[model samples]
Target: MRIIVYGTLRRKQGNSHWMTNGQWLGDHLIDGYELFSLGHYPGVVEGTGQVYCEVYRIDASTLGELDALRSKGGEYKRQLLQTPYGSAWLYVYQRSVAGRQRIESGDWLKRDAVSE
Candidate 1:
């Protein structure tokens, strides 16, 4: 299976260590969703805007590890989304983003750059 990571789990970001054994598929854009800042990490909520993501092919065990890292169904919920690469599971924010900053460019690192 494959998963789409849009936040801290992408490449060189913090917590990316969890994805060390997975195969990198490439960058992908998830449509009809938005990214928001939640301090250290970013969240993807169903809305309007392209969400930049990285695809990784992983096994059941790797997925399980990621689920644990993401808090599975608590702070984030897993959802299957269609991207240019294919269908992949994404961790969507389960809480309200009421006061958080929205990442208009859909790129977490780009948003971080603007903040800096």
Candidate 2:
């Protein structure tokens, strides 16, 4: 299965282990979506315009390992998303925050940039 990854997973020296072993399918943009940081990883949400990120094709067996690393049962959940490249699953935060402003896709900031 293919997965769209953003944030730390996008960086070469970070949590990008999946990319080294998995098939790199190049980068693509997901329209009507935006990226947000949820502590350790990033969450992609439905928004306006296009959200850009890299994608990887991994074996289905690896899903279990990925789920554990992402704490799938807790804060994050995998959801199906349609991007310009194709369809894939992405991990996103499940908890809701009232009045939390959804940033535009073009203005979606990266965690590393914020720290810098």
lDDT of 1 by residue, 1-116 (tens): 89999988999999888789999999998889999999988999999899989999889999998889787559988998776667889999999999999998899989856653
The local distance difference test score of model 1 is 0.89
Prediction 2 global C-alpha lDDT = 0.65
Among these predictions, the greatest TM-score belongs to 1
lDDT, each prediction: 0.89, 0.65
In candidate 1 the C-alpha lDDT for residue 24 amounts to 93
TM-scores of the models, in the order given: 0.92, 0.72
RMSD in angstroms, all models? 2.0, 3.7
| CA lDDT, candidate 2, residue 12 | 73
Positional deviation of residue 80's Cα in model 1 after best superposition, in angstroms:
0.8
